[model samples]
Target: MCLLLGVLVGRAVPWMQGWRTRAAHRAAEQKLDALYSQYDDIYHRWDE
Candidate 1:
């Protein structure tokens, strides 16, 4: 299954630390940006 494969990939490589760490940071930043944009849209009115 893909889930198992992903888990194996995530854990099986010691040489993937920098790439994996950057990937995680990029993911977190994207999530944070999405949440902030959502909150901004919810709170601000364009034509009020």
Candidate 2:
């Protein structure tokens, strides 16, 4: 029973880590996109 539990945990841990990594990467990309959008808006307004 313990061995089974350990094996399950071993698999789960890597999967969870990968999921967290992807989420963080996605969040960073979103933040960068928002920043660029804001910058573009400000630039266009200034140009007018």
| lDDT values for all models | 0.87, 1.00
> Which candidate achieves the best lDDT against the true structure?
2
The best candidate by TM-score is: 2
Model 1 global lDDT (CA atoms, 0 to 1): 0.87
Query: Where does model 1 exceed 4 Å of error?
Result: 1-15
Please provide, for model 1 over 1-48, each residue's C-alpha lDDT reduced to its tens digit, 9 standing for 90 to 100: 999999898787865887799899999999999999998887787635
Residues 1-48, candidate 2, lDDT per residue (tens digit)?
Answer: 999999999999999999999999999999999999999999999999
Model 1, C-alpha of 8: deviation from truth (Å): 22
Per-candidate TM-scores read 0.59, 0.72
TM-score of 1: 0.59
